[model samples]
Target: MHVFLPDGKQLDLPEHATALDAARAIGPRLAQDALAATANGVLTDLVTPLPEGAEISLITKKNPGQAQSVFRHSLAHTMSQAVGEYYGRKGFPKEAVKRGVGPSIENGFYQDFDLPEPLREEDLPDIEAIMREIIGRNLDITRADVGKAAALEQFSYDPYKVELISELPEGEPITFYTQGEYVDLCRGPHFPSTGKLPTAFKLTSTSGAYWRGNEKNPILQRIYGVAFASQKELDEYLERLEEAKKRDHRKLGREMELFTIDPLVGKGLPLWLPNGTVLREELTRFLREQQFQRGYQGVITPNIGNLELYKVSGHYQNYSDSNFSPITVDDEQYMLKPMNCPHHVRIYAAKPRSYRDLPVRLAEFGTVYRYEQSGELNGLTRVRGFTQDDAHIFCRPDQLKTEFLNVLDLTVLVLKTFGMNDVRFRVGTRDEGGDKYVGSDENWTAAEAQIIEAVSEVGLPYSIEPGDAAFYGPKLDFVVRDVIGREWQLGTIQVDYNLPERFDISYTGEDGQEHRPVMIHRAPFGSLERFVGILIEHYGGDFPLWLAPRQIAIIPIADRHNPYAEELRAELHAAGLRAEVDDSSNRMNAKVRQAELSKIPVMLIVGDKEQEERAVSVRERTPEGHKERKGVGFDDLKAELLERYQTRA
Candidate 1:
């Protein structure tokens, strides 16, 4: 059989020869450095037999993207071996510790073990030390395929492994990897030897996870660790983790009094505090104005709708798992609307239109409900109920590209407004030969083509993702990277022919005959709740002046200057600035500190001398540095703030 390399070199090898054999054939150094390989673009273990006439690339520590996974997964196995050794030293029988599945994840790897006793956080250091010792032993790792009967017999004492083997399909190969005294059931392409594995790894923590992720199954101690090819990369990642902890939205939300969730109000439902509401309202107002200028007419819809509406939209069939049960009332059924598209569809269907009205753009700040499981719920990112900045545009086929481009413009404007400049696009199209999507193949092709063309015309950096499309249509998602280099899917614009046809909505075209209109579904802010959560974390809860809930804090030097502070606050409010006076009986410095803790954008200090001068001491919070401009006229200060607020500076 012949295998190819990226340089177009071909090598002939015997049948059943693996990537390791090919690497050895290429050169001794190549074989020694090879950690894994890819056969025809699919990552493969070095021990796995390469397909005939396949293209293979030998992965080494230098290949960060692919090498990281192989290294991390191999580390997981080593960690398991270390755990068993640790337990053995503690006087437990080798067979007493049952091992479950372990796999490599983003930035790290983890393994699950059903231990005789629960593992504590303190055990991680010892486990990590054992892993280092195992690596130092230079153990030769090898993979082998075994018969199911023999594999099950070998793991008879471990029910977790037995259950896994039992669930394998008939005739599937059962594979295992061995390193010295530790043997694990895994299909792996490990390094040539343990000595080749990088030493830049640390066992971070341990947590409880159910066997196979099923609640009814036995709980196992899952140990997590992060690894990298170089210590520098690992250190950088660890630093990012520390910064992420400090910027965690949930913690910042409590300190900033942005939002809250209570068990009594139901899980995953966030109650927006006054400060949080101000943020929400400001964002809404900004987008509302943008939409109004873009020819979007706002509409209001009910929280719940007739059950049949979703069925017609095909959401009920596709998203039933994420939807709450129907509410039956007097022989009729209703449900909390999980999407606003269906409601907007009804709105379009309510009236007939001619070619002049081909493009009917309807926008709404629609709140939706989905049945998210308790475990999946986070602060606000994963919630049962949230509001979408949704809109649907029904236009003629010829206008599809133009409408999509317009939606893309709005999405870009919205993202840039929040200073999210590092953006990428993903054009999600249906998978070929898949039954999951709706609409005719011709319609799907046309809709997908329009999206691709629009994205190309806009010259946006994008990649096409198969099987990431909505069930009803293809979409373009705007993925924004925040300040800390975390990516968030913030906005989406989908081109749909399914919903309009499913609802049988039509408009008169130039031919004077009724024709099905193409629908475009767009949500610049995907969801207000999730967007705000990302924003809070992105800015580290210190929002920009335009988005700050309390734009200015007026601190009085003493109680005697209360009237002057109030007068300044009124003037600031009159100029459309959000300002408040610190009326509490506290020292001026304390008041300033409290205001700073609240993350107010600007602080105005009032004193007897300032009142006599009819000027306020302005302390403006700039990203570069905080500055104090003394003896500034109140009117001048108000003008500058109003200018910043208007320009969104």
Candidate 2:
């Protein structure tokens, strides 16, 4: 048989030979170094038989991404073996532990097992030691296909495996792999021997999971582990993990008293506290003013809509799984609105538009709901109900590019104002030959080309990602890297040509004929709850002066000066600053400590000399230690502080 190399050279091999044979024909060293093979982009084991005229490329450690995935997959099997070994030494039978699927995940791998006893966090170290020993023994890894009846007999002890084999498609091969006294049902592209595997892996934690993700199945214990090609990468990842714990939004939200989820209210429903409300309102107010300046009219929509409304937009078909179930009032099915675009579409169709009103921009801070699983819900980032800084533009067909660029500029402005400097764009195009999307071919093509053209015109780097677009359109999504070097998907702009056609909306053209107007959907911050969560972590809870919920604290040195402290608070309040007086029985030091702990931007100290001189002692919080300016004139301090806060970071 003949096979083609990556450079388009042909290699002749014996008929029905494997990829390893092709590698050996190329060079002896390649065969020795080849851990896996990619034939025409299909990743497979070195021993897998190659098809004639296949495009073959050897995957070694030099192929970082593919090699790491293969290694991680094998590591899951190794961990499963170690678990069985550890249990055997504890006087349990070999069949006492049954294994479920073991798959490679982002940054790591996990294995699900049904064991005789529940595993504790402390048991991981000993099991991990057993894994090391298994690797040291240098066991050869081999794969083979077996008949369905034979495979069922071999895995009779594991009902999970039995069910898996029974579910395989007819006429499909059932494959399995083996190591020293340990065999598993797997289709693998693994290292030739355990000795070739890297030891830079650690089992981090354990949790309970169902056989699959379904709640009706028996619970299995899942062990999570992370691996990398080198120890340096592993160490860096561990450091980032530790820092992430310190900057966790959940912890900070509770400590800072920003937002809370009350069980009585419901899970995944966050109730913004007074402090959190101020932070949320500031963001909304800023976006609203920006929209107003950009010629956007504000609008409000109902929280629930008729089921037929969503059915028309096709969101009912695409999002029904994640969306809340409909409620029946007077035998009518009313759905909690899952998207703001459908409502905005109705608004555009409400009034007859002309070509002169080419671009009708409508904006809203609309709250929407989705039925997220309890397990998937996090603090604020993943919630059941949240508000989006959403807007839609109905423009003439010829104005699509201009409207898309305008929305892109507004999104960039929002990110830049938040100090998110490291932002990149990803253009999400439709997946080829996919049926999940709804749109005509010509519309999809035009929409995607316009988005790409607009992004390219901006002269910023962007990547084209297939299967990332919405059901109705192609989108440009902003990925922002935070201070901790973690990326978050923040702002997005989508050009949609399907919604207008579905809703049958149109505007009169210059030719005195009606024409369909294209729709541009944008949200600077994807959602208020999620954006605040990312912002909290990005800033590490030390918000800038302008965004600070409590901008200033006024502390009295003694109870006798309480009256004067109240006067300062009133003055700051009248100046449009959020200020409070610390007139409680706490000492001066306690008062200052309390203010600093709250992350207040400024603290004014009232003393006898300051009161007599009509001045005040000022202390400001900065990234560094406190900056103090003593005995400043109260009038001067107010002017300087107001200017500083107004300047904003």
Candidate 3:
């Protein structure tokens, strides 16, 4: 058989010749340095048998792709071996440990073990020592194929592995890798030997995970570790993780008194405090105003609906697990609305329309509910109930591109108003072979093409994501980056052709005939609840002047100046600014400190001298820290505050 190299060279070999064999045929030096090979673009172990007429490239430790996963996966096995040796030395018999699956993940790898006793933090160093010893032994990593029955018999003592093997379909290849005596059922590619394990790996943490991600499954102790090709990359990743920990929104929210999630109230439901609500309402109002100017008519929809609505929308069949189950009464079933499109469709059909009214844009801050697993819930980022700043536009087929452009513009304006730049678009479309999506190919193709053209016309950078589209149609999701370099999908604009056809929605055209109207679904702030959560982390809870619940807190120097502070506070409030006086007996410095910690954008000081001059001292929270004291006229300060508020600075 003939195999082709990436450089277009052809090599003739036997049917079962391995990549390592092919590399040796090419050159002795190539064979010496080859750690593995990329066969037809798929990574392969050095001992993996090559298919006839395959394209192959010999890969060394210097290659980063498969080498990383292979190295980390081997490290996991090595770590497991070390763990067993360490526990055995501590008088725990080798048979006392029952191992689960150990696999490499994005940044590192982890192994689940059913240990005789739970592991302690103090055991990590001992485990690491054993792992290093194994690495020093330079144990050869080899693979062996066994029949299903033989594999099951070999792993019968480990029930988890037995279960895994039993579930594999008949006639499927069964393979295992062995580094010395520690053999695990896994598919290749692995490093050449244990000696190839990078010195930059570290055992990070231990947690409990279900045997196979099912809550009802047995919980196994999971040990996590991170590995990289070099110490520099490992150090950089650790630093980024530390920075993310400090900027975690949940901690910042509590310190700022923004929002709270109570387990007693049930997991995944967030209660927005008064200040957090103010932030939400301000965002809503800002988007509403911007949307109104761009021809969006604000509307409201019910939070629950008859089950039939979702059935017609096809969400009932496709997303049953994510949504709340039905509530039945007198043979009628209702579901907590998980989306707003069906409700908006009824509104569109309420009145007869002509071609002049083809593009009917309806907007709403609609609340939605979904069942998020308890284990997956985090502070506001993942919640069961949240409000979506949703809108649906019904337009003619030819008008799809223009309507999409308009939605894109609105999304950009809304993002920019919150100081959220660095935005990109993801054009999500249907998978060619997927049965999960709705609509005819012609309509799907048209909708997807419209989005691509719109994005090009708008001159925005975007990526085409197959199978990432809505179940009903193609979409453009606007993603933004936060301060810590984390990316989030904030705004979205979708071109939907399935819903109108499903609901039989239509409008009278200029020719006085019925025609189907294309629909564009858009949400600038995907959800107020989630948007604020990202904002909390993005700004570190330091809201902008306009959005700050308490934009200015006036602190009196002493009790004698309380009346003056009250007068200044009332004056500021009368000027339509959010202001408060710190009337507590706490010291002025304490008040300033508390305000700063709460992330109030500005603090106004009222001293005897300032009162005498009919002025107030200002301290603004600058990126570098609090600004220097500057005294300005009370009215002058109000004017600047109003200017900033109006411009949303």
Candidate 4:
């Protein structure tokens, strides 16, 4: 058979040839340096048989993207060997530690094990030492393919591996890798030898994970590690990870009294306290005004809908796995709403429309529910229930770009208003030859092209992502980087042509005939709960004055001045500011410290010196700590503070 190199050079070899053979045929120097090879854009082990007419590129350490994964996977095997040795030194047999699967993930690799005893944080160092020793031994990594009977016998001591082997279909290749005294069942694509691996790895932590992510499966301990090309890169990532720990929203949420997830209330449902509610209200009002300016009318929707509604919208058919099981009521099935688009569609179809109503905009802060796995639930980012700032625009085909651009403009404004300036979009189109999506190819292609043209005209960078689109049509998703250099997928705009057809909704055209209106589903804040959680971490709990739940904390030095503080509070409240007076028995300094801890944006302290002139001393929180402005007149201060917050400064 003949194979091709990257530059289209052909090489003839015998039947059942491997990449290693092709490398040697090309040159002895290339063969010696090759760790692995990329066959038709997929990285593969050199020992794997290369197909006829395959385009291949031998990979060395120079290939950053492909080589890192190769060595990282090799490290997983080496780490497993060290784990067994560690257990051996502890006087435990190899069977005491049952191994599951391990794979190279982003920035790291991990292996799951069913251990006789749980591993502790202090034991990680010992594991690392054994791994380094194994790598230093310069053991060769070799592979072999075996028949099912032999493979089953080889791993029969381990039920996990046996179960895996039994599940493989007939005629599938079973391969195993060996280095020194350790051997394990795994598919190929590893480094040439253990010594060739980089030492830039750390076993970060360990947690319990189900064998295959099913709650019903046996729980295995999953050890996580981070790997990089160099120690410098690993060090930088570790530092960022430490910073991220400080900015964790769950920790800050409790400290700042933002929200809580009570087990009794449910796993993913968050109960917002007063301060947190204020945050949501402020964000809602900000976007509400923006929508009002763009002629969007707000509407309400039910939390649950008839099962038939989702069937017509294709949500049930295409996304039933993520949706909760239907509720049977009087022989009628209803489901917790998985999306707000179907409800918005009914609203548009409820009334008659003409060419003047070509673009009917319906918006809602609609709460929707999904059946998220318990293991998949995070603070607010991944939840079972959340509210969406959803809006659906039904416009004429000719007005598609204009209306999309209008929504895009509003989305940009919304993100910018909260200091999300660094942003990019992704055009998620349907996967070709896939049964998961709805709509015809012609319509799918048109929607995808319209999205591309729209984002391109706006001159924002975007990348095409196949299989990331909505089940109904193509979409454009926005990803913004936060202060700590973490990128988040916040908002999305989808151009859907399938839902309207399935629902049979239309508008009268200028030609005096009923015409289908192209529907654009948009959510500027994809999930309000998630958006707030990101904001909490982005600002590190130091919210801007306008967005701060408690904008001001008023303190009086003496009880005699409590009445004055109350007066100041009422006055600020009337001016639409969230203000509270610290009338607790705690001393004035303690009260001021408490305000700082609560992360209030402003503090006003009144006493005999200031009360004599009906004034207050102000302390404002800034990026560089709090600044004090003494003896400011009440009228002047009130006016200045209100203007600054009103302007969202």
Against the reference, the lDDT scores of all candidates come to 0.90, 0.90, 0.87, 0.90
Deviation from native of the Cα of residue 320 in model 3, angstroms: 0.9
Arranged by lDDT with the best first, the candidates are 1, 4, 2, 3
On TM-score, the stronger of 1 and 2 is 1
Best by TM-score: 1
What is the TM-score of candidate 1? 0.97
For candidate 1, the per-residue lDDT at 327 reads 97
lDDT of 2 by residue, 208-252 (tens): 888888777988999999998888889999998898898898998
> How well does model 4 score by local distance difference test?
0.90
lDDT of 4 by residue, 120-171 (tens): 9789999999999999998989989999999999888899999999999999
**Once superposed on the true structure, which residue ranges of model 1 sit more than 4 Å away at CA?**
61-66, 216-219
Residue runs of model 4 more than 4 Å from their true location after superposition? 1-34, 50-59, 62-66, 557-561, 585-589
- Runs in model 2 deviating more than 4 A are 4-10, 16-19, 22-31, 41-43, 59-66, 624-626
Q: 489, model 1: CA deviation in Å?
A: 1.0
Worst ten in a row by lDDT for model 3:
60-69
TM-score, every prediction: 0.97, 0.94, 0.94, 0.94
- Which portions of model 3 miss their true places by more than 4 Å? 63-66
